[model samples]
Target: MDPQLQHSVAESVATVVISHPEKRNAMTAAMWRALPPLLGELADDPAVRVLVLTGEGGTFCAGADISTLRGSPQEAQGLAVRAEEALAAFPKPTLAAIGGHCVGGGAQLAAACDLRFAEEGALFGVTPAKLGIVYPSSSTRRLVSLVGPATAKYLLFSGELIDAERALRTGLVDEVLPAGGLGKRVAEFARVLVSRSQLTQAAAKEFADGRTDRDAHWAAQARASGDTAEGVAAFLERRQPRFGWSVPTSG
Candidate 1:
């Protein structure tokens, strides 16, 4: 089938599947351009409490389709950076459910997500060096933050693929599932995310991403939101808290 991004929402979880199986789900230029707007729609949807990004079939993205680079590598890279930034900025919790190869631009997208769960045999790499192209600074810093300077340098400098075990050891992946188990685990975790307090998740996402200026704003929100009270009451009453707070919509 043609390259595309297929998405659906169920039980407050939005799953975006990258489809380009012929090329191991390599993202084309148009696919990169399409990602941000799609994410914007999902971010604005009240029903979407979480997002899971994964590839169609067994493999995650192999990277950008190299043929798309013939016109202008810079433009292609720019689209990728924009897509990556959009994923990073998505308001709700975002998870990458990875399997097979997650390389080059694929790794960039995975790193942008809040968490990554990879299958046992999944392989990951950041491959700009292999093509003599410079990886974007923001991507580089994000990679360093996830895996530290030395490990990031090793991946960047060598363009070598690492297995899921190594990736988990280096903090590149939050969990490594056995083959055939990724989907079940991701769905289970996503349900847990959906059941939590959105007010807390949104604020924590921003803070974890290094935004310290929202202290007063989050404090005001917390005071106004009834989530804390509900949580306390639920604890005392021996029941699950029904959190009603959601991320504020932008005008």
Candidate 2:
């Protein structure tokens, strides 16, 4: 059976819940493919300024459904790769509300987003080492971008779980929320993401993401793009300017 998503549309924020707490919401092959389209809906909705990804029953995710993986390792691995790629391609600001176990491919899912908010006691792990599975190159780069080379190496090679505080210190999570009011805090935090200027945020995110290799031409091209123009115009005009954003065209 397909796992049902708990959808919420409130105040221009689309909250997508991974509902399979019985297994800590481990994503099946189907769920992996389902995510991008669901997120795309929110990404295209002018009314939805933010897209929040979370899991049901206080758990974020435990990675790809391992039991299913045991059946056909190659197929399951392909699904994870495809899903991760889709997530990375999503345009707009994305946030993850992480609680409980965020392990293996779950960690990949969180890392794909623009921002992460984890509650106290959240556990994060990259378990490919344990399974002898190789992570995709882009995912590895994203992880390294999040926490830097040494920390990324530690997480990848060690596959050890890190607490929320440690994850925050390592830059794995943008912020740590109190365990008691985590849900409400996630909602409030998502509001901040929603209220932020899409133009400025999108450009900044794009600029930061593409800055890794430092291609002078690519950087200049982004600035030449109308996003920069609209951002400057909005600031000078003291008004909101619509941003016509699409999936980032550059790596």
Candidate 3:
């Protein structure tokens, strides 16, 4: 099949599959341009409480399709950075359910997500060095935040692939599962995310991403949300809290 971002929502979890299996699921230029709008749609859907990004088959993504880099490198990199920023800014919880190779642009996208779970034996790399192209500063900063300066330098400098075990130890991935188990584990965790309060998740995400100016805004949201009351009542009454607040739609 042609390269595309295929998405579906089930049980309040939206799964976006990068489909370009012929090239190890490498993203073409068109695919990069397509991502932000697709994410916007999912982000606006009240039914979508969480999102899971993964590859179409065994491989998560092999990186950008090199053949599409015939244009100005800056133009291509700009598309990727915009897509990465969009994913990072997504209001709800987002997870990368990774398997096989996650490299270059693929690794950039995964790092944008709030969490990453990789299948054992999966390989990851930031490979712009291999092509003599400079990685974008925003992408570099995100990588540094996830795996620290030294580890980020190692990946960026060497363009070498790291195994899942090393990635987990360095904080690149939150969890590592055995082969064939990634799907089940991601589904279970996504359900857990869906059950929680979106108000709390949205606020925490904003704070964690370093937007400290929203303290009063979130405080006002909590007061108006009624989620706090429902949570307290649920604890005292021995029932699950039905959290009614949804993330406010972006203008």
Candidate 4:
């Protein structure tokens, strides 16, 4: 059976699962093609506060399915880059809930996300060296920005997997959880995100993602949104803040 990208939503968080556990959830070409539209749908939804990417089975993605990897190299690479960019550019927060092996393209995907959480025993690698292919520049830069150039070279040059503790030490993953704790921690963090003002979060995400010149616009947006006033009122009233802001629908 072909691999699939499946998704579901609950309590303002959307979960996108990479489902091909027969090959340890390796993504097929079709799965690469499926990502952007699925992510766009979620990005356009007002109710979705955050997105979590994970695998269907115990293991996270084991990278691209080599057996089914047949297509024009340019087309295949283009599709993969497009999918990665979509995930990276998603307006809301994105997190990767990793377990087991997350290698090659899977590592690229995780790097595209804003944060990563992995189980203690999970393994991570960037394996273009093993396959005799060049890693994409964007992904390379993202990895470098996360882990620094030295560690990025260490991962890409060797193509050897590192355990979760090492991954955390190198800044590849934000949090490392015990075997059964990942899901709960991710859910809790997602809920915390859901409770924040979208206006504040979205602006902060944009700035952090390299938008260098939106000062006036962001200030105007914040003033008009009233999120600060509501937040202050809630603090003074000793009540939970109810933020009504949502991302604007993409045209």
Candidate 5:
């Protein structure tokens, strides 16, 4: 199938699938350009509490379609970078479900997510060095944030493929599961996220994203949202909290 970005929702989680079996789900320039808007639409959906990104045919993205690189290298790079930034800035929690090859730009997309889960035999690499090209500084920093500077340098400098065990050891992946049950596992986690208070999740996500000055504002916002009261009531009543709040629509 031709490469495309498609989304579906179930159990309050929007799953974005990258499909291009012929090329191991490598993204075309058009797919990259489509990502930000797709993510935006999902972000605006109040019912979608989380996002799960993955690839079809057992592989995550292999990278940008190199066959098209020679024709519009600059455009492809720009679109990919924009898509990465959009994913990183997505308001809700985003998870990458990696099954097979996640290399080059693929690694960037995975790093942009809030969490990453990979199958036990998945392979990962950053191949800019192999192509005599430079990795984007922003993506490099994100990689460093996940796996530390030294390990990030190792991947960038060597462009060598690492197994799931190595990726987990380096902090690149949060969980490693046996193949065939990845979707079930991710859905379980996403359901947990869906049941939680959006207020708390948004505040924590903002902090984790490196914004520290919003403490007072978030505290006020939380009080106004009434999630705290509902949570306390539910706890005392021995029932699950029915959180009604969603991220406020930005102006």
Candidate 6:
């Protein structure tokens, strides 16, 4: 069966599932290409204020298919780069609900998100070193920004998968759930995110990704925008702030 970008909605949350179980949720060039536009459509919807990316079965993602691995170094890097760009550019809050394995390109994809949660038995790695593939400088920078240089180097050099506890200790995962509870826990986390102010979420998301080249000085303006005002007002009144009520006018 072909890969699919399955989408669903609950109030302000938009859930996107990577449905390619036959391949252990491995991503393909087409799926990587499909993601940015799909996210754009969901972000454009006023009712969609948060995005949850996950795999259909127990696995989060196993990385690129070994079957479709043919490409120049630049081509492979470009494909992975675009996938990361899409996840980073998503306007609302983003979360990765991780399970079995998040390796190679899959690891890079999850790192692009604002937050990540994993099951007890999850594994993570950047296996390019073992595969004799050169890791992109941007991906290396992002990894270092998350887990620090020493740990990043260890992972890259060894290409060894780290367990859930090590991943949590290294700050790769915000929370860890029991194997059976991972899905439900991630759902709860997504719901909690959706309950908050979209504007604050967007600003915070950008701030958390401050190391990214695109998250420059304009973030200050974003944090102080009308959304912050409405959010503070709603907090004082003890009500859910009506957010994503309209599309943001471009500058």
Worst 10 residues of 4 by lDDT: 67-76
| Residue pairs whose backbone atoms clash in candidate 6 | none
- Candidates in order have lDDT scores of 0.96, 0.81, 0.95, 0.91, 0.91, 0.81
- Candidate 4 lDDT: 0.91
Model 2 C-alpha lDDT per residue in residues 18-130, reported as the tens digit of each score: 88888989988888777767766666676777778899989999998888787888788787777777766666778889999999888988998888999899999998998
Q: Model 4 segments beyond 4 Å from truth?
A: none
10 residues in a row with least lDDT, candidate 5: 242-251
RMSD of each: 0.6, 4.0, 0.8, 1.1, 1.1, 3.1
For candidate 6, report its TM-score: 0.87
Q: For each candidate, how many residue pairs have backbone atoms clashing (under 3 Å)?
A: 0, 0, 0, 0, 0, 0
How high is each candidate's TM-score?
0.99, 0.83, 0.99, 0.97, 0.97, 0.87
* Highest lDDT against the true fold, candidate: 1
Candidates ranked, most accurate by TM-score first:
1, 3, 4, 5, 6, 2
Alpha carbon lDDT at 231, candidate 3: 96
lDDT string for model 4 (1-251, tens) is 56899899999999999999899998888899999999999999987999999998778899888765565656666778889999999999999999999998899899999999999899999998987878889989999999999999999999999999999999999999998999999999999999988898888988888899998988988888888899999999999998766799997
Q: State the RMSD for candidate 6.
A: 3.1
| Position 143, candidate 6: lDDT | 90
Off by over 4 Å in 5: none
